[model samples]
Target: MRIALGVSYLGTAYQGWQSQPGGKTVQDRLERALATFADVPTIATLCAGRTDAGVHGLNQVVHFDAPVERAMNSWVRGTNRYLPDDIAVQWALPVPATFHARNSARSRRYAYVLLESPVRPSVETGRVGWVFRPLALEPMQRAAHHLLGEHDFTSFRAAQCQALSPVKHLHRIDIGRRGPYWRFDFEANAFLHHMIRNIMGCLIAVGQGLRPPDWVAAVRDARNREIAAPTFAPDGLYFLGPVYDADLGLPRHTPAFDWLPL
Candidate 1:
């Protein structure tokens, strides 16, 4: 039987989403937990998106072929028993064999939460990116406008990114601020590695008056990574999850979505 799970995790302690030799990734822990629950030597899982170290996942979807039949709820409660406190299985469903967690996704969403204050983050240290300087909403919004459509994002992509193409269709970019907190939302057909973080660095630069709004357009057109701002920290990045067809009957968001400051 093919099974799908909605998992969430605090990525601060993990190496990343993919399995590694040290077995310190979220995938490693999850696969081991699934294996233990099924009484099998191993059970591999494929996730809709891979998050980097220090990034969080609000609802990461994964699918694995089960060797034994079990109730859907059992998969949630059983696998979670062996998982760490910071990681958990939120929901589970039976999917058709033709369904793929990654390829079937229509679009993916991400959010970056930033704390704009002279004081460094205390209670929310690893949960938010910090910027000491005050930010202007107008400049950042204008800069974001340049990235709203399909374009080559080589300037924002990480050098290590293995994506076949740098061209991606950015569906939306929403920038909102509530007091000292700033939230940036991105929806796209897909994102290159460190794409959002790289953009964040550029946006922050414009917000701080270090660069003009038109500089963003120039950077985009240049398609040169060196000319753009440095990649921002991954601490505040969150995979809001992937959007799939409604006919598939998958949950769109998890409860943790409400917890974000946005």
Candidate 2:
């Protein structure tokens, strides 16, 4: 049976989600834990999206076909026992033969939390992105409007990205501010390497009055990565996870959902 797992992790100490040679990634730790719990020599898993180092995952979906049989509850509880404090299996389910953690996802969502204050982050140092300059929400909103729809996002893509197409459909973007903190919510068909972080950099630039709102559109049309702002810090980026159809019987949220902005 194909087992689907909802995972959450603080990527501060890890090298993102994909497994690496050094075994210092979230996938490495997860595979190890799964293998130990199932009494298997190795267990391979695939993620819905690959996050950069220092990024977080709120409810990352993953799937694997295990040779041994185990109860769903045991997969969660037992696997988590072998995992680190910052990483956990939130939920487990037996998915249909066609259900894929990545391919079956209809949409992927992400959120970036920012601290806008004169003082740098203290308690949430590695948890939130910090910008000492005050930001204007109006310009940021104006800039976001231009990015809603299918377009070539090469201007915001990382050079190392292996995506076949630079064009992607950005379904929605919501910029919200509460007190000194700013939250940016995004939903899309998919995102390229550094796509959201690069967009954050441009949005922050426009918000800080360094560039005009139309600058975002100009950069998008330019289709040049060098013309856009630098990629923003990965600290604040969080993979809220993927959305599936109701018939799939997948849980869309984890316990950490309440701790973040709705």
Candidate 3:
């Protein structure tokens, strides 16, 4: 049977989401726990999106096929028993065979939590991105305006990125402020490699008065990676998860979503 799961994890310790040879990746640990719970040799999972090292997942979606029969509730508690504290299965669903974790998604959302303070993040070290310089929200908002809608994000893509197309539809970029913390919400049909992190770099530059709001459009027009700001750190980048059809009966949110700056 085909099964879908809502997963949440702190990516600080794992080497990104995809399985690696050393077996330290999130996919590695997740697959192991799943196989152990199912008493199988392996049960591979496909995630809606893969996050980089040190990145986090508030609600990540993945789907796998099960070889054995088990109650729906057991899929959550039983599989989690073999998983680490940082990794968990929030909910599970029996999905149609045609359902896909990645392709079935309509859009993906991510948020970059940033802090403005002289002292770096101590308690929330790997959880939040720190900017010592106080940022102006207006300029960043102006810069974000140009990023909305469809555009070729070549300048913001990573050199090692394997995505075939540079053109993507950026549905929204919402910048919200709360005290010393800033939350940048990004919603897109899909993203190129390091797209959000790169855009964050440019937004920060404009927010810090290092660049003008129009500079963001200039970078996009240049279609040159070097013209854009460097890719921002992955520390604050969280996979807010993908949106699927309600009829699919998949859980889109987790408890971690409540703890975020959302």
Q: Kindly list the per-residue Cα lDDT of model 2 for residues 65-172, writing each as its tens digit.
A: 977999999999999999999999999999987778999999999999999988888889788999999999999999999999999999999999999999899999
Clash count of each predicted structure: 0, 0, 0
Q: Please state the error at residue 7 of candidate 2 in Å.
A: 0.1
- Tens digits of per-residue lDDT for model 3 on 58-102? 889999999999998999999999999999998998999999999
The reply for model 2, stretches above 4 Å from the true place, is: none
Q: Compose the digit string of candidate 1's lDDT tens values, residues 1-262.
A: 8988999999999998999999999999999999999999999999999999999999999999999999999999999999999999999999999999999999999999999999999999888999999999999999999998999999999999999999999999999888899999999999999999999999999999999999999999999999999999999999999999999999979999999986
> Positional deviation of 93 in candidate 2, in angstroms?
0.3
Candidate 1: where are CA atoms >4 Å away? none
Alpha-carbon lDDT of model 3: 0.94
The lDDT, on a scale of 0 to 1, for candidate 2 is 0.94
Q: Evaluate residue 129 in candidate 1 and report its C-alpha lDDT on the 0 to 100 scale.
A: 96
